[model samples]
Target: MTEQTNRPVPNPCVGVCALDENDLCIACQRSGIEIAEWGVYSDEEKREVWRKIHLREQGVLKE
Candidate 1:
């Protein structure tokens, strides 16, 4: 296992629970599928999602 797997990744849900027209959570910026699959994702995968969320928040990623 990778070092990332040794650490537990926290869920990004902010309890907003609303999706935008693009199907991404209004608060967490995760897609509907992403939210649904979050529990099954490995730590590395979750980290990747967090990275994407950060990029989205930084305006580096539009979608």
Candidate 2:
């Protein structure tokens, strides 16, 4: 038998677009500032948030 590994998923845009001083998603609790600054952020940074936000939504990670 062979073992299997799980694949990564994409982000969930809940339409809860609201930014506090930190610019984090008010509903999903994602880093709003990070999202906004994505235009300037490197691919690695964007990837980091994508991974974190997904984990957060699935209750696998905490804010």
Candidate 3:
């Protein structure tokens, strides 16, 4: 199998059982929509999520 070029989506679960008012993860900060559609998302779509989480990890984003 060929390797993927883009960064992979992160498993950003923090084990917290709460979804904020906007439905974004309290820990990972991904939107509820993002979470719900994750399974069906293409690898390209997952790359977007990876970008978001990466920014959050770098302290460049909150949600």
Candidate 4:
């Protein structure tokens, strides 16, 4: 496995779990599916989710 793949990615959950109308978490901004499957996701997959969350926070991506 690559370095990134071997490294652990932190979960984005802030313990304020609530879904918006778009089904995205109001706190972490992850989709319901992403949150549900997070435990099974590879480090790379988790990183990708974090990237999207960053984009959402920056207004660079939506949904």
Relative to the true structure, how large is the alpha-carbon lDDT of every model? 0.91, 0.63, 0.73, 0.92
- Per-residue C-alpha lDDT of model 2 across residues 1-63, encoded as one tens digit per residue: 222213333344577788656556767567766656767755556567777877876878764
Ranking of all predicted structures according to lDDT, beginning with the best and ending with the worst: 4, 1, 3, 2
Better of 1 and 3 by TM-score: 1
Q: Which ten residues in a row have the lowest lDDT in candidate 4?
A: 1-10
- Residues 1-63, candidate 3, lDDT per residue (tens digit)? 346655565555677747788677778677788777888888778778878877866879764
Tell me each candidate's TM-score.
Answer: 0.87, 0.52, 0.62, 0.87
Q: How many backbone collisions does model 2 have?
A: 3
Task: Name every residue pair that clashes in candidate 4.
Answer: none
Cα lDDT for residue 2, candidate 4: 84
**How many angstroms is residue 5 displaced in model 3 relative to the true structure, after the best TM-score fit?**
4.5
Per TM-score, the best of the predicted structures is: 4
For this target, which candidate reaches the highest lDDT against the unseen true structure? 4
The Cα error of candidate 3 at residue 28, in Å, is 2.2
Model 4 per-residue lDDT at 36: 98
Model 4 spans with C-alpha error above 4 angstroms: 1-6
